[model samples]
Target: MADLKDQRHPQYMGDRQIVTDLLGTTQPSDRNLADLARLCIRYRGFQGARDIQADLLKVLAQWHLTEEQLYAKTREIHTTAKVFATHNDGRDDWA
Candidate 1:
């Protein structure tokens, strides 16, 4: 077996695309709930998936915001920040 130092410290098991998919279907269903829960647990303390985890929790917590409120807020955080990208005229979708 490989030593601890030799082993790869993989990033958290979640990604932004999955988070967006889950957010796309925010209904209170078993699959959605499970996915969100899994994300929260997987990204408990890791900084890489911090925003991804927060987005999951925001839907799980049911904040009284409009339909696109959460997505809009998070989307505004440009791609350079490693969040996600938007294909709008003024955004960097290639980041």
Candidate 2:
């Protein structure tokens, strides 16, 4: 099983790309933002996800994302993660 910090997870990698593209960054990649989104989903079944969500919101504020936009994107990521978790039996299948 891939750990939360493991960006090699397909779901995490996808989310990373989504966030990177959304932020419109042409510079070097930074995993912090994407990692936060990954963690939010990785811990979806636990309170940890909430903590991560709060942290992500704080970071998003700095990025100037409107509340509606943030909510939509965050909700989308969370839903995708939930679906992935459900279908994969709560384990990431990178094999």
Candidate 3:
């Protein structure tokens, strides 16, 4: 049988680095790294949504807006963008 350690996928290796960087750990245990890699690959769109969500919450708090309010504002912005696009010949120049 092939050795488990030898079976580490390239994507998992890349994810291991991302996991370590996000956790601020240089050398996490093999098991912990494997678990993180698996979780990132299998769920949350293959990215660390947990940490990103926390950061987004902090930004929202700093802006003094609730989650629902943020969504409402985002929708408003998109609607405005569509109007602008119509005026600009269907070109979305706003990034």
Candidate 4:
């Protein structure tokens, strides 16, 4: 993938750096990046584009995200976490 540093947007550039540190040559795509970006915004309640990009970079760098048949799996995970937090009152007692 092209160097994320080459991206114009400040958020995109930061994310690219973080993702590169985290995922190396496997920088995330528009779709996955978008979802991950959105989740960061939602969870952090105004996590500017830079923050979203940073979070996405952390996630990608830490995971072995598959390249084929990509989907919003990260978003789903974020959604599930939100639902779990809402329903379980931020506790693990519900199991």
Top lDDT hit: 1
Residue 40 shift from truth in candidate 4, angstroms: 14
Model 4, stretches more than 4 Å misplaced?
1-7, 24-69, 82-95
lDDT of 2 by residue, 1-95 (tens): 85564223335456545554544543312343344445544544543334344544555666766555544666666655542324646665332
Q: What lDDT is reached at residue 18 by model 2?
A: 51
Residues 1-95 of candidate 1 have per-residue lDDT tens digits of 95434222154333577677777774644444444554555666554555676786776557444435544444444332443224568843221
| TM-score on alpha carbons, each prediction | 0.44, 0.29, 0.36, 0.28
Ranking by TM-score: 1, 3, 2, 4
lDDT of 4: 0.45
Give the alpha carbon lDDT tens digit for every residue of 12-54 in model 4. Answer: 5544454444444355545444444444443343334555455
- On the 0 to 100 scale, the lDDT of residue 49 in model 4 is 57
Which 10-residue window in model 1 sums to the lowest lDDT?
A: 5-14
Task: Output the lDDT of residue 25, model 3.
Answer: 44
Candidate models: Cα lDDT each: 0.52, 0.47, 0.43, 0.45
Candidate 1 deviation (Cα RMSD): 12.7
**Candidate 2 ranges with C-alpha deviation above 4 Å:** 1-28, 48-51, 66-95
If both were scored by TM-score, which would come out higher, candidate 2 or candidate 4? 2
In model 4, the clashing pairs are 22-61, 23-61
**Candidate 1 global lDDT:** 0.52
For model 2, how big is the CA root-mean-square deviation?
10.4
Report the Cα lDDT for candidate 2. 0.47
